[model samples]
Target: MKPFYIDYPQEKIAEHQHAYRCLHCKIPTTIIFGLLENHAKDCAYRIHQGRWTQLEASLKPIQKHFDEPHIDEVD
Candidate 1:
């Protein structure tokens, strides 16, 4: 089976979607499921209808798993 990363169709999403800036990382990112919707339940996000929100508000913790180091050993 393809890994989640492999399964995720980034090219399609990238061509048409906008991403919000991460509150903690200050990097452009999407509001991930479960993390924003559940785990960080108290957090808030400014979901603008027209365009991506600027890094004006220190709103919420968004997913950033791609930047994290792997648990397994790396060569």
Candidate 2:
């Protein structure tokens, strides 16, 4: 899982020449700090992504266990 959420949609803040924010949550990128939880509780992007993250985590497959091949097995 990504430790930060920097890929959310963003748009220029109205009347602010150098400010931007999340399109769905309207929270400033600076405030969000690339963390999904920083978004508003009812934010569309946050809700969608939060569910996806949880689902992915729950459905993640376990790694397969295996042993290394012996040196004598080399062809």
Which candidate's TM-score is highest?
2
Could you list the CA RMSD of all candidates, in the order they appear? 17.1, 3.4
* Clash totals in order: 0, 0
**TM-score (C-alpha) between model 1 and the true structure:** 0.16
Give the range where candidate 1 is weakest over 10 consecutive residues by summed lDDT. Answer: 1-10
- Candidate 2 residues lying further than 4 Å off, grouped into runs, are 62-75
Q: Which pairs clash in the backbone of model 1?
A: none
TM-score of each: 0.16, 0.75
Q: Estimate every model's Cα lDDT from 0 to 1.
A: 0.33, 0.91
> Candidate 2's residue-wise lDDT over 1-75, tens digit each?
689988889999988989999998899999999998899999998998889999999999989978978788965
**Candidate 1 lDDT tens digits, 1-75:** 111211111222344455444453233345443133221333233233111223433354675667666779595
